[model samples]
Target: MRSPARRAPRDADSLWRWATLSPALLLMAALGLLPVLNLFVLGFFDVRWTDGGSSWSFVGTRHYAALPGDPLFRASILNTTLFALGAVAGQMLLGFALALLCHKATRGRVFWRAVFVLPVLIPGIVIGAMWKLLLNPEFGAIAQVFEMVELEPVDWLGEASTALLAVIMVDIWHWTPFCFLLFLAGLESLPRDVYEAARVDGARGWQELRYITLPLMWPTIVVTFVFRLVLAFKVFDEVYLLTGGGPGTATEVVAFTIYQRFFTEDRAGYGSAMAVAVIFLIFLMLAAAAAARRRVQS
Candidate 1:
């Protein structure tokens, strides 16, 4: 058995650790947990806020029950799913390729890294505004590029067919750099000895990448994939700034849907239900990704 005197120091250290963490825990409860709890509470009721939300009434599961048949909500889900899939896949692939190229280069690595990361340093609102300007129909960036190619000047963000795709493209442009940074970090952390051994055995670039680099970087790939997907699922700020979920709701994602319901339509309860649904979808995605990561590791 350990001495009582020895146990005292360990107990004190544990107390010290919790003491250090208490502030963060309190902050999280106030900022994150309380809002989520309010959303959950509001989800199960009918809340009309003419008198500072004092007009709330218990209408259990009414908003949730109507979710399955809500046309706008369904459209929002479809649009969001499509955007997340397209943007995440594009960003991940482009980012990984760029990371590989940069990692293999011997000169100007810092400059190239900075170039790749520049978009990420910019804010979402600025990116949205920039893209909006670029995609303008007349006398804009895309119009100038179109003139070079002898293509007609077309409104990129004003058409239902192109609006969602345009937003997805903009999202990919801004977030691909984030994925690139993660991939670069993962590539840097890979074991150099294994690559050296593979080279000694006359392994080609493709062979080493296929058999060594990919296998080692699998965890990072999963993490990056999951993170990008989650962030994409929550996309709203840029969409709001650029398109305002317009082109006849073509670009209206789930986040925008909730925003419209709560703030625009004054359906706070329904919006809260949608928020809970978004949380559920995020939880499911996280769970699925965690399971996949475990499978890969095992």
Candidate 2:
């Protein structure tokens, strides 16, 4: 049996470790949790800014009640859902394909990785601006390409039908590299012996990928999907920079709608409600994904 005296130094060391980590833990709680708690509380209030001061009146779910009846909010919710689904789907498919290609490459893997990751390093705002210019129907690179190809120049961001799709494409371009990096890392970390055994059994490329690779990589795929879905749901920069929710609220996502409510309309409480609703919706989506993963595993 270990003596109490011997355990004293270990306990002291454990306390010292916690003491060292306390500051960081407190900082994280303050930085991450405080704002969320504040937002949640603010969602139930009617905050009005007076002369040099702000006043809060308890509204008690009025903002949440209004959400279902607000036409703009409904539109924004639809647009946000569409954007998230489209962006996540495209990103996952393209990223996984790129990962597979890079993983199987015999040479130039570093170069390909750098090329793929370049878009991810660029700021989202920059990507929005760059795509805005490229998709311009008048005197843009895409316009020039259209002219050269004897095709009509399409105003992707100007048209209501194409605006959301354009932003989704831009988001896919920007974030696919993130998925690629994750999937590639997942692929590399997979046990090589499994592949060796599959090869010895004369498993073809498609068969190995179908039977061995996908099953092994399911968790990674789920994680990437959920992470990207959350990010996609929170998309604001592309709509803000590229379309500004123009062409009649075509690209008005939840985040941009919240931004407009808080800053433009000065409706802080209602905006907070929308923000809280979005968080709840994201939680539901994550829960659904988790349930799906559990079913698959079972």
Q: Residue 262 deviation, candidate 1, in Å? A: 1.3
**TM-score of every model?**
0.93, 0.93
lDDT by residue for model 1 over 1-298, one digit each (tens)? 9999999999999999999999999998899889899999999988776755458899998889999999999999999999999999999999999999999999999999999999999988788888889999987888999999999988889999999999999999999999999999999999999999999999988999999999999989999999999999999998899999988989989999998888899989999999998899899999999998888788
- Which stretches of model 2 miss by more than 4 angstroms? 1-16
RMSD of each: 1.8, 1.9
lDDT string for model 2 (1-298, tens) is: 9999999999999999999999999999899888888999999999999999999999998999999999999999999999999999999999999999999999999999999999999987778778878988998898999999999999999999998899999899999999999999999999999999999999989999999999999999999999999999988888999989988999999999999999999999999999988988999999999999999999
Where is the poorest 10-residue window by lDDT in model 2?
Answer: 124-133
Clashes of 1: 0
Which portions of model 1 miss their true places by more than 4 Å? Answer: 1-8, 19-23, 51-53
Instruction: Write down the worst ten-residue block by lDDT for model 1.
Output: 47-56
